[model samples]
Target: MAAVELTVFQVILLFWSLRTAVSQVEMRCPSSCGNICIPYPFGMEEGSYLDERFKILCNSSSGVPKLTVDGTKLEVRDISVRRSTIGVMFPVVSANCGGKDRNTVVDLEGSPFVFSSENYFIARGCGNLALMNQNQSTIGVCVSICDKNRDSMMASCSGTDCCQTTIPSFLKVFNVTMKGLDDGKGSSGEKQCRYAYLVAQSWINYGSYYSDVGGDSDPYDMRHRDSVPVVLDWGIDERVFESLVKNGSFHNSSYSSTCQFLNPSINSTNQSSTVQCSCRPGFEGNPYRYGICEAGRAYDNYRRKIKAKMAGIGVGVGFGALFLLIGLWWLYKVFKRKRSEKLKKKYFKRNGGLLLQEQLSSGEVSVEKIKMFPSKELDKATDHYNVNRTLGQGGQGTVYKGMLADGKIVAVKKSKVIDEGNLRQFINEVVLLSQINHRNVVKLLGCCLETELPLLVYEFIPNGTLYQFLHDPNEEFPLTWEMRLRIAAEVAGALFYLHSAASLPIFHRDIKSTNILLDEKYRAKVADFGTSRSVSIDQTHVTTQVQGTFGYLDPEYFQSSQFTDKSDVYSFGVVLVELLTGQKAISFKRSEEQGRSLATYFIMAMESNCLFDILDPQVVKQGEREDVLMVASLARSCLRLNGKERPTMKEVTMVLERIKKSENLTVQQESEYDRKEVMGAPWDVTSASTISSFDIGAPSSLDEKPLLHTY
Candidate 1:
């Protein structure tokens, strides 16, 4: 009776699986156009269609299948099920070569498809201008110019013989037209055809489809004749998924399928919400079919065979052997646990955990101040160091967001290098940060040493870095002039404390806008002390390898390999310039004459009496002219080529503080006061006769010797 029941159950299971597979096949569209498979949701036959937009018409009158979208007769080259895009060929218009001027217009209005952002409007020909218009409004124009006598060299659409520009995203329709220059004249008296169309970046960049020249050798000639692949993004309303789920539809029927919401355009509405579906992670099959999320067939069959053998063994005197094997496994686990613990202790010692304990015990360092967390605790907190928990990355190492057992959020810094030198620095950071107490500095909570690389835990900063606030377009709130001034003052104060008021004189070698973080209140928090050096009271400066960001590095220290308090001041001066201009430390978009550093451009502007030209408009409007000039002048003195001419961090902090307080002071009075107090002050760098008061201008001093820029 038992054997009969088991057989009956097995038969039922087999029947159910077979029934599900057959139903899935029937629901899915198995039709094809030549070699291209028309999957479900996209159908070539009326019975296989799920909607009118998905209907693909196939013409086979010529004995070759050609697919058209929605009976529009536009040939479909290929379809992408994963990316939710289709490649179609569009007509291209040309001039000068006398090709028929068929101005191509791709009209996709009221359709589920839009022009993908991955395509570019490109025009290939000299002495021609390509104009792209949308909704009868001119959107962009690209002109290519070439000398008649010069040899033509094809470039990658960089405004040379071929000119290209990016099209707007979410564009539903566009018209491409070309105009010939100088009465339809061609380059070098040879008729050149101008081709303009929207083409996929991948296809154009591949460069494998160019036509054979046959000694004619026009680079713009296309091998595929009048057709080029154009990519279109397709999406449908999210309600489709809900309907499928509620009605038990086969479309996206797999259990391991997920839906993604598309980025809606400004004109998107509830009736036209866009969504897409794809197979979930670790599953690869047709998402529109039942049982689509199953693992590979080979693995499933192997597992079944192994299970059958195990069942037979269990029914025939294998219980005793199984019990013995379980006992051995338990012993092996215990041995492995002990070995792991031993290795953890070894790593702890190697990472200076023992030395830290010794220092605490001897009263050389405070006791029970910095916690030493176990490796397992940190690993669990960070979910085995998942990439999703990553807060940010830098040249030093990666930082991950972690939650402690006590429900406290923290930042876990994982250093990349484990060299002897870096190990010492890591230990030093622990020691210094444990004793250091400052509200504007990031707090060191604890550390974990069991891992190959040491991990440092710091108090989590809620807001992003100042760089994001200054440059990121998506930042909800703009950095106002008042806020920038306050932030500048706060960072200057922090640096002042580090340079003069800390337990030891610490020099922050790297000080830029990026290194400065903002907290919940938008207050500045100076961070990243990996390259900081501590100096003794008797020592004037430290001579070591120069290390800092390219645009912010102090030119004097960069050329001398000698770092001092003034070096940090120079970097901070660059930060001051950043705050003033709202520009990056190194900007590639600026004109070639400006050089890479904003400091150089700012200095030029100040020298040329065009300070307002480069000042942030916000700063100009909110700040008084005299105040803006004062701050600009202060930044200029800080950025002086001579280290001695730069004001100290203390002076910078005082000036920013005074500027913030003197907002109500009249311009006349302010100018008079500046002339009286700051006339002979070291901050004055306008005239060449200003003398250095800090003895930094002498060549014999290491503080004045310029360093080489090379590492």
Candidate 2:
């Protein structure tokens, strides 16, 4: 029995299928362009079509008849009906010859026309192997032997720089991959690069088989020389050209253009058994005749003269209409601009810009140190805040790059969606950020309120967020041991400043690496205070609704609504694990044993004494495995589910500083002593003697692993 399907979903799908079918409809061709009479079975678009199968695209981007088929352009010079071929200029390969230093690349991401079984492949090179495939299925492989360009090269396909092989007939979708073969051993010289192309029949001279040059090489040089073009046999419904000599007619409008079947003589190999009907030359409306080919002036110019004159009068009226349209368009643009200005003014007032200005005048909202950028200024800086400017994206909003009037660069954050609920919070964040002055925090420069949504401006940090630098593949910056320690220290200090040094004790509820911005020199700056709360000086903890990034959220706070300074420490601990392992805090790629969060993995690794295994090789290269281990251990201590078990941000900062100083002292002592002297030169994971061991089987020093606990 079958499952019952939803009626509404089926109806929607049926409607969509019908729409797609109607859009793909085509007609036969008298597709005319530049005195070239195009025949039936060729199409341009919906209105002017020959047939779907033979569609020709006239790209007018450069104001010339540059042609394309399916989106890939082929320098199509001519198409001969009798010859059944398209003359195209396939690009030639150029070799860069440099001794011992070489790089060869071939990109065929987009192209049309498949390698047929009738097509042949020839190669010339030593230490080279050629491979060709289609749709992940291998067709053939060829290996060549020859190192340097010899003075007298052989003209035979005899295991040397030359070899030839043919492909299966009428095959579509081809991909070529090549490598160098060094004797049977592997690669050497300029011959290491293998070059191949489908050669045009004209380029293949009688005596030019596998030789680098032609016999009668004149001043014209005989050919361009690099890529030798091969001819591909093309047909509608046949592999062999002779098979197209059909017995009957085909109604091509029903499917993707029909012709004779895959045969030498027409006895249709097609599903319906071959019947072909091609439109006659010079007279093409449609094979279906029902297929629409809108009337063009050149077809019946004698009768069209009067219609053409009236068309010219209509064209003049059209120009007047176009002129009226242009005038209306200009007027519409002016109206749009006025409407936008009014909206901006409305938003400016609504966003408390007037109140901000009043505060600025009264010395409440300081404008001297902060900025008030015009919306236009930011739009030009970020190319209207294009998708490319996006630094990171999430459920909240997107951050962009912007430049201020004073020549300072800033990060402009635009909300994903704006409404009344958070509008006051947005303004408050900016106002609070503007008042803050701290070296360890990402500084708020200014903001733009006269836009659809509020735009937050902050000091630009070029090194990106610590999260991306630690884990994103696209980001090449791997967190080195020293850099990691320094970043951790800086982040701790920043949090300490936010918690105490600020006018109010601010809880940066989200303190993950993703929220920590880095400057050019890897200077850490704490950011993303969207979930932060301001509490009184005497308060040790604040009661609030739980909210933060998953993987780094304080477990205690998540379970209970109470958040504290230790909550920030726990979140920062997740950042520390990221720095050590060079993996995402919440990575999907992990063994089932190692939980999703980096903190969980780090704790597991620390417990198992396999923390070194999870660390980045770049950090391992830093020769401070002991110091790295200590930091990982500290990070482990911070991630303890119980808030009481986690270190204070102040202690975290102090311990990190002590670790750096101790490493420096150890290095100095090793330099002062002989090879055999001193406790150890530096920590090295590879040098087993210097590696530190952590106990895995023992119970955690913390009381217990609580199911959930906040600060």
Candidate 3:
């Protein structure tokens, strides 16, 4: 009897211990502070969060509960566990120049948060120059200009009284200074109040502050508010979680099933070894909490089946075979899913996903514009890369026309069997393309890296390449002189943007007619960036392996392997020659004297004073003689053997714009003259000068001789 009583006592003790463990695992904590939901790893009290850094304070003295972070008391607006981002209200710094200045400094020194690149640094005031400094170094600058007209001052932040620029990624702390131009002297001789701050880009676009302009208030005036919304990216260190796992202290039951570690490259000497944790597919909720990530509907259905089977165990004996088959099928599906996920992860790592992630985390590349597409989605979009969907094939890869699930048409580029050496180039293309926002540059919609080869998705251009239009004539759509000139101007503008206007200077190593695509509107969109590279602002050249189309390749780059922006100019010059002659860059059918090169042939024709003789008959017929001569001169300047002697893309763009403007004005004048007189003056080509005079804007190297003068 005593033994039996002891057994009952032991059973109760075991049940009590089990219940206690379950209770600890399911312990409830405050989920929110006012409107912001505080998900674990982040909490309002000790023992509720993963670490001291994630602790937040809730203040309700102002009637409404407010969540604040660290000693800065930055008000928390929202927290997203899925995106690992927190929205906080950051104060705007105002400076009154010669008066009381309110320059603010934000320091997040020891926190796990970094300022997101999706925020923009804005400065608002007339004739004020704002500079954002980090670690005493100027990181960003923008100048606001006031309109000369006082009564009709523009109420827009489009560089008039307000200017905005993007902030760098991985930024932890920064300060803003608003310096007035000419010692704060305003049009009214009154000291101007300049406001500067970093705000979420999306918030600036949709916020009510911009639309709240009334009476004489400035449109960008933020004096009424103390702060604006800013985005902060937060992540936990991978080592901390790994240590917990090793010590058997991590109690999050759903962590293994829901969370995956984002391993960014770590620099122990200079930076913290931090990593991001995100919930896995088919799961939702806090990954840092015990059993918080709830399963999706499919998982819930599977659980229901298990529960049903357990409840009907006795009945299942009669239909044992049927139950066994269902169990086997379910097991097969689960195994297949796990295997597929493992393979995808392997491919992702192999295809430079981790390297790209490092670049993104380091703020070297902006992540807002690029998307990671799933392999299955791309496969379906391209119909398994059907032959019929093929758009074009190149040495680098093949492009396919695809329709996404949303019925959006895109051009998908699938790389060939690239070795590890070329992998960096592939990734380089993705990073460089993501940063570009010019209209004439091809838009990178997204990419897929989980397959054997990486895939890049771009906006589809309905019209074919410029090379096809120039070399392969179409009866339905003829290439006119005006269209060619417009295309040339647009291409030059794109190259200029790459070289000068971008956040970083980009060198398009390959610039050929075949690489320039035309959209439905016949607008030029520069494509094929597999060989492109971005250089620092101070870097004049990048020494790389000589790679370019033979005829279009810069001679200096081929010999020295030092590629500068001028290398691209040389290639563009060849494209110009192609436009003028309407012949292949390299033709074996040409005579030995022409050296099988169109560039050489065109130069020879120009020197011999018979450029028109070699020019396409259609070009001579449709284009004005003087306009043709001016363009030919510009092309010659660009094709200079010495890279330094060649005109920059900026100079080329300016000269082309001037020529186009002149053509427009001349056309208007000619139209008026024809209306006034029945017959127009005839041209005397024999007596007229062989070369037309126009400013080519060539570098000082060309100052010795006129661009259009006879050799």
Cα miss at 705, model 1 (Å)?
14
- For each candidate in the order shown, give its overall lDDT on alpha carbons: 0.71, 0.59, 0.75
Off by over 4 Å in 3: 1-320, 664-693, 696-711
- TM-scores for every predicted model: 0.57, 0.51, 0.51
Q: Order the candidates by lDDT, highest first — what do you get?
A: 3, 1, 2
1-711, model 2: which lDDT tens digit per residue? 011125334544655554444344323325554434455444456645333445666654542233454454554455544344555444433233223222222222222233334345554455556666655667667666774554333334545665556655544434565666656444353454455544453445354443544553321122335433434334443322222223213333423222444332212122222223333432323332332222222234333454466467556765447667557767887999999999999988777677666655785444455577889999987878965577766555889876656777778888655566765556657666776688878888778888877787878999887777765644454566777788888888888777768777778888887788889888998887766776778877878767888998988888887888878888888888788778888877887677877777776666565767878887778847557656765676677676766656666776677677777565434222122211223222222111012222223323334334433
Q: How do the residues 1-711 of candidate 1 rate in per-residue lDDT, one tens digit apiece?
A: 344347556765765575566456444537778666777667777768557777777766642334344344567777776677877776676655565555656567656777888888878776668888765777779887665454454434566567788988777666777776653443341355677777777776654544332333443444225666678888665666567667655445455666667765634333255666666764445554432443323334554665676568658846567667667767887999999999888888777777667666787554357888888888988988976698899988999999999999989999885676666666767876776678888888999888777789999998879888877734567788899889989999998888878877888899998889898899999888878887876665788887889999988887778887878888988998888888998988998797677988887777666778887778988887777766776777678777765677877787788778777877565343343223223434344311122122422322343233433
Off by over 4 Å in 1: 1-79, 83-326, 352-368, 665-711
Which candidate do you rate higher for TM-score, 1 or 2? Answer: 1
Clashes of each: 5, 29, 0
Q: Write the per-residue lDDT of candidate 3 for residues 167-206, one digit (tens) a residue.
A: 7767777678777775334343127777888888777666
Pick out the ten consecutive residues of candidate 1 with the lowest summed lDDT: 689-698
In Å, residue 345's CA in model 2 sits off its true spot by 2.8
